[model samples]
Target: MSKKFTIPSHSEIQNAKSNRNNPTPAIFQKRKQSEQPNESIIEENVPKQSSEKVMNKTSTFRSFQSDSKPTVPTVTPVSANSSQSPEKAVDKSGTYRSFETVNRPQKPLVSTTTPLLVNSKQRGNPILKHIHNVAWEYSDIVPDYILGQTTCALFLSLRYHQLHPGYIHERLKLLGRTFELRVLLAQVDIKDSSHICQQLANICLLADCTLILAFTPEEAGRYLELYKAFENKPPDLIMEKSEESFEAKLIDTLTSVKKINKTDAITLYSTFGSVKNIFTATEEDLSLCSGIGPLKAKRLHKAFNEPFIKNIKKKAIEEVNSTEVKEKCEKGIGNENDNENEGC
Candidate 1:
């Protein structure tokens, strides 16, 4: 069947066009209120669907998180009666360990052999080896007594080139019986060769030791001749008793009396010519001598000029007694002569 087409009237179309173009105020207000209600409905419906989608997404996230979590390992406590050591268990665990289970260094084992046994063959002599070892291993190889003796001898030798026998004997007494003469002499430092010869001569005179000098055959005969001449030489008694000359004797006398040395004595003797002259000379005269200072001159002058009171008193008494005795003898002789004449 063919549907009949209907067309709007002209008046109705014109009225619809007028309503769209210019609507009343009340109609516009009604349309806006209607649009507001529809928009509120759309907003409410959109929020409900969005909230449901968010809830579904959160549930899916929670399931994924549960599946991805790692499992915690379980640990079984080791029994005390276990065959393995605690260190072995700790090593197997490979995570945590105690300080007691850590590896420690071990000490090496040492043999019980003596040092002498080990080194004697290489050193050739056990005694020498022991001495070397002791000397090398220790700082104090010298004994306290030896050091003390050396120190004392050094001080004494520095002061006096020749040590007295009495003083040495006293020191020996203090050192007891174990003191060594060689060691003491080795420690003494005599600076001069002449002093050493003098010391050797003095030692020969004082001690019982004999010194021998060995020489090559080429020089032996010459030395032998010298030795013979020395042996045949006369004793030095005269030289010891008297000096080489009167000046030397005068120097020695001045040294003895005035406590001056040979140099000063020589200077004084050369200036004064004689001991009597030196005694009579004034302090000014002594000071004028070479090498004689004012203090030494004054000392010499005072010693020589001071009179001997005891001797003077003794001489005066003897003279007085002699005069009185002579007078008495003369008077007795006169009386005796007179008596003898009367008797005649």
Candidate 2:
């Protein structure tokens, strides 16, 4: 069963190659037709189906994404309003007006039931008799009198001050500067009162106090009574008034004396040309006026050029000032340049 090994001729091989190129060979042509259908089938039908599904899915996704994307907004312009209330509405425009105010602080209330509070030690003093104009209460106080919340007074009689000159210094040192207003009410009682008053003035000046000199105890008591009565009143109540009209001024000036009235004041102005003429007029000339009587004329004439405080012999104060006193020459030193204690 062995076969012989033989090589094909070249002409036979050529003829078979020529057959592969020529589709007229029945078997080869049939094979090529079957193979071409399989390869071309995938290329035409499968690619079309697969590519159409993928294209549809991608196109749908792109459409959905484009629809879901946010669009650009349109901007609108707003105009400013002329008036707006801050209590209700807000101002969003360019212009805004605002105001701020503060509540006025309530004034601090000052409460004082009694007008004056006197020291219990001052119960026997005569100043209490003249204090009838205002109510007063007695309390154990450091100062002799207390007029108001911030005012206090220290009483010193010149008669007593002469007996103990060092007493006031101790009292003042103790009093210090506790009160806003301190008053040193001095009643002049001695012939050497001038010297003592100077010393008191110096002491009061150094101690930050106002010194009031009273010649009589009655005057001093009147001052104390008035101090309490007018504590709350303004200074203009007792100060000299400046009237707007000349008639008002003349009437005020003419009615200043006791027992003179407005009727008499007007009558005198009508009778006399001016105040100069009135001042030059005598009692007889003044009495000739319509309403003024003899007593009033004489009183008015006396009031014209009279001294309020007169006939008091006030001698010059003695050289008791520490600034003016000569230093002591103890040990009798002879050098001119040295102090008196060390020099002659």
Q: What TM-score does each of the candidates earn?
A: 0.23, 0.38
Residue lDDT tens for model 2, 232-285: 788987697677999999999989988999999999988997999887799999
Top candidate (TM-score): 2
Q: Which 10 residues in a row give candidate 2 its minimum summed lDDT?
A: 94-103
Model 2 scores a C-alpha lDDT of 0.76
- lDDT tens digits, residues 224-293, model 1? 2333234325567335576688777777677865657889988887777777888999888998988888
